[model samples]
Target: MIQPIFVYGQHILEQPCTDIQLESPQLQNLVNNLWDTMRNAQGCGLSAPQIGLPYNVFVIDSQNAFQAIGKGFRKRYFDAEDKGIQGIFINPQLLEVSSKMWKAEEGCLSLPSLIKGVSRPWQIKISYYNEQLEYRIQEFSGLTARMILHELDHTNGILLINHMGLLIKKYLYFKLKSIKKGRVKVSYPISTR
Candidate 1:
């Protein structure tokens, strides 16, 4: 079943998530629900904290239509396949990052309407354990890199709002109020404050 994705400014996104035990069924459920919620919301990735789960699990699907554009060269190099709507990561750890940085508009599933221009590394190499507890290392670039970094931030209790300046934060604060009143189609998650 799809779970409710917690809105932005929730305390959960600021607290580090616990690492998952490879053999735990609770970890499996977290992976499942993250994927379900990501797909249901048409998101390219989701983290456990976004759904109020405090586990280091996240779902990524790079094959979505939006990712196809501006990613042709990257696709050829990564050989990304249609992984059937979900790639689950458990206890993911960032190993290294390239010096290249890319600026892009970033949004959070937890913060629906909050889109901001943020700069992130263009590529990263990450090591993580899969469902069967086997360790794997993969290189991600471009949009995939951005998605990975965003989800990983959730595991570490970071949010895109943290990157926003004071003016932007104030803007979102008032916008969040309108969302709470149902006056707008919420673009970011409803603030818990």
Candidate 2:
């Protein structure tokens, strides 16, 4: 069964995730649940903290979504399709990021009723272990890059609202209140209206 995702302003999203050791069955279960939650929500990615689990675990299905977005860095290192965009990332460490930035609208499974415009690095090189505990280095650019950065932020207990300007932060506070009061459902594109 898919677990209930924690909503916006939850304390779990503010706490850093613990690193996952490859040999642990607990890590495996977290990976499985994250994937299931992402697919169930039609989300391109998910982090363990979104489900009230504080572990450095996330899953991404970048290939299909990348194709859907119509553009991506073509010097491919991993099979966009075969990678299934559904692999587990454990103890992820973003080694480097490009100076360039890209603005995109981001949504979270945890904050299912909201979306927001945020800027993130346009490219990044990340190192992480797979479910089997094998180390892998992956380079991502454009949309995939943004998704990875967003999930990484979740692992570190950061939220898109935290990156927004002060005015935007104020707007989000009220918007979040409205959400809690059942005044809205699924704030599309950007929630800070």
Candidate 3:
């Protein structure tokens, strides 16, 4: 089922998520919901907190992101096809990230209609439990790494707005307020209350 994403001003999105019990019913449900909700909203990633669960879990399908961006990066980051096994990282740890960074405009399902330039490490090493509850350690670069990092931030109670520069933030102030006030429009379901 596609659950409504918690928007800005929602307490749940700001609260840090806790580690999920491996192979548990709650874990499975959250995984399913994250996948469904992310695909439904056309998002590259989704975290448990985005859908009201404060558990350490997030899903990433950077292939879609890569496809949208075009041919140049298709093979550089991930398999653009065979979409059956997307990254469903549970109890994920960002053990390493390169000092070299890439700045890109980032957005969130929660904060719809908002995108800001945020600099992130170009490469990363992470460990997590897969969909089958198997332990895995993987390294990623380019869009895949960026997607994972963005979702990981959600589990840590960090939003894209937090990474914006002063000028960008100042420019977005009233627009953000409009979102918080329910005056802005969003395609996906969001709970701002």
Candidate 4:
């Protein structure tokens, strides 16, 4: 089922999530719901908390994002090898990140109509359990890394807006306020309460 995404100002978006029980009967359903919800919203990634669930889980399918933007945009920002990744991440751990940093524009479904240029590591090493509950550690670079880091922040109760400078936050005050007050319009379903 495609769940409604919790918008900004919802306490669930800020509450840190707990590790998912691998043996739980609902694990697979939760994973499917996340993927469905993300795809329905046309998002590259989605975390459990974004849907009002408190589990350390997120789904990513950057291939959709790349295809949506077309080849030229992909060629400009990504390497030939960066085809993008598609998978579920459960109880993920950030093992390491490269010193190299890149700043790029990012948007979130929860914060509709808000986009910001955020700086994040170009490469990341992460360990996560896949949909089958198989544990694996892997390294990711470029756009994939950025997407993972963004979703990882969600599991940690950190929003992309948290990365903005004070001045930028001040500049976006009214817009943010409107979003928090459930006044923003978005293509997908969002729950402000």
The candidate that achieves the highest lDDT relative to the unseen native structure: 4
For TM-score, the strongest prediction is 4
User: Per-residue lDDT for 1-193 in model 1, tens only?
Assistant: 5776776546788899988778776877777777777777778888888888798889887667444555555553233552223467889999999898878788766666678888988778999887677899988776777778889998999888888889887867877665445455543333343
TM-score of each: 0.83, 0.82, 0.90, 0.95
Candidate 2's residue-wise lDDT over 16-68, tens digit each? 99986677778777888777777777788889988888988888887666455
Tell me the TM-score of model 3. Answer: 0.90
Q: Give the candidate order by descending TM-score.
A: 4, 3, 1, 2
lDDT of 3 by residue, 46-165 (tens): 999989988999998865665575566555444445222368899999999999887877888889888777788888899998888999998878777888899999999999888878
The CA lDDT at 59 in model 4 is: 92
Q: Kindly report which residue pairs in candidate 3 clash with one another.
A: none
Candidate 3 least-lDDT 10 residues? 76-85
**Candidate 4 stretches greater than 4 Å from native:** 70-72
| Model 1, residue 28: C-alpha shift (Å) | 1.7
lDDT of 4 by residue, 1-193 (tens): 9998998899989888999899988899999999999989888999999999999999998776666677878875566887887989999999999999999999999888888888999889999998778999999888888999999999999998898899998999999899888888777888888
- In candidate 1, the residue pairs with backbone N, CA or C atoms under 3 Å apart (3 or more residues apart, or in different chains) clash, namely 111-188, 111-189, 112-187, 112-188, 112-189, 113-187, 113-188, 114-188
